[model samples]
Target: MIRLRAHHLLCLLTYVGRGYTPAFVAQYSAIVARLNAGEGAVLVEGPDDICAPMLDSGHHCREPRITTRDALAREAVAAALGQSLAPGDTIPLDGPTIARLRENFAAGTIRAACAACQWDGLCSGIAASGFSRTRLSGAPV
Candidate 1:
């Protein structure tokens, strides 16, 4: 099933097919299978390496792949996903959800999630640059 941390899913929105190993693409296929099923995807806020296989794709640039078991992290992730997700909520990682995220990101609604991200500076730069870039390195977009 396609399960992921909120930020990882966020990263996928801008994925332009770079930096991933072939194996990761296979894994991604499976994830997509679930996401396409509307209710087969899972979202979490703690201790799950949902994005591990694809983190090296550079879309995320070492930003956290798993949310931490903390109130702030959970809250931020929930804000990002636009739902009150717990550690194992079945969510739809489909177009509408992702589209909402994209709009929210452009409109500054997902800043809370960015607050919990290590890539905050890079994300800020992306936002500042009017989202001219999505695949960023840790070096400030």
Candidate 2:
């Protein structure tokens, strides 16, 4: 299973082969491929697989603001999916599920956690463009 922070579930909706570093992009791209191939995702509190590449660089994965973002993301996503999600909860990255999440993301209903995120504008652009060129499979074509 791929380990991911709750906020990453929102991030995946707009990933377009860009990231903080080449290694970060590469790692995230590979994770997206795995998710496309039907990998399961396990929710993690902080510093998940995607954050591994940045850990050595003193990344802010452990910061309080990021932790709060995670909590907000978890709450919003759980409400969107109508499921209770915890740190250890496993989420299936299936086509329908991804589609549903993307729909909610584009509608701005599940975006409270993204308010303070640096990539919010980028994500909003992606959503506005109908998720075009996003790496995630099962996105609207």
Candidate 3:
């Protein structure tokens, strides 16, 4: 289960698996493994090893990260909407505010977790096309 932000949820919706490096792919595959059971979403939670962090530029994926981006997500969203996601458990990527989040991202208010991801453009394109309408292949959210 990978904990995710609006950015990651959108990226996975448009992901075609070509931009990241082999190391990144290998690391990502570990997360993909969880999808076999058909459990995937922007926000997810699973067994320890399978529950990958929202992989960011901060991750080289060669070692354990001493810090997590939970605060970054809280700050970004709270700064934008004055409320933060609790994400108590795995959350499938489906909601009414997908477009609102996208708009915030474009305005630079909802960008912390995604500022460094290479898939930024793709996610933006997907969002631009209408985030609430976009859907991932494996799950409704």
Candidate 4:
């Protein structure tokens, strides 16, 4: 496996969050191969290839701009929250929080709640309750 930089991971994470298909990896791989073939300074044809590090680093840098910005925002939020984050496997909620979340789910407020929730897409319970695409990445703690 090629060593991925922070920016590369950020790109992949952003695409995953946007609900892109799993085929994205293949596409990125092809782009990487092209980049490795002395085409590092070339440009990609679309936003679909934004997660490619070489593409982002060169003339085809436009597509990855938004992805990069989102990654930065995510990083800032993560820093503010600090490490040792609660895993999505367990939704940590007191009785009141659970009730409120359930109520929100019943009232079609899952989007609002998910927007406010850091766990968002990571939580299977939350995702099943509503909103599928919450966070961008699935890095295990």
* lDDT for each residue of candidate 1 in 57-93, tens digit (9 for 90 to 100): 6554343433332444446546776568665776555
lDDT (tens digit, per residue) of candidate 4 on 1-141: 233322332232223233233454566645444433423221112333444434534443354654453344334323332432221212222333333433444454333212432334444454454433323222122
Worst 10 residues of 3 by lDDT: 43-52
Model 1: weakest 10-residue lDDT segment is 132-141
Model 1 — TM-score against the truth? 0.53
Better of 2 and 4 by TM-score: 2
Pairs with steric clashes in candidate 1: none
lDDT of all predictions, in order shown? Answer: 0.52, 0.90, 0.47, 0.35
Q: Rank the candidates by lDDT, best first.
A: 2, 1, 3, 4
Per-prediction TM-score = 0.53, 0.95, 0.44, 0.24
Ranked by TM-score from best down, the candidates are 2, 1, 3, 4
Please give the range of 10 consecutive residues that has the lowest summed lDDT in model 4.
84-93
**lDDT tens string, model 2, 11-116?**
9989999999999999999999988877778999998998999998998889998998899999989998999999999986777888889999999988988987
Best by TM-score: 2
> Candidate 3, residues 6-108: lDDT per residue as tens digits?
3343344444443456755555455544553456444322222322343555444333221233445445655555554555535443333444455676665
RMSD for all candidates, in order, please: 7.9, 2.2, 6.3, 13.2
Candidate 1 regions off by >4 Å? 20-22, 37-39, 45-77, 80-82, 112-141
Is 2 or 3 the stronger prediction by lDDT? Answer: 2
In terms of lDDT, the best-performing candidate is 2
Q: Measured by TM-score, how close is model 2 to the native structure?
A: 0.95
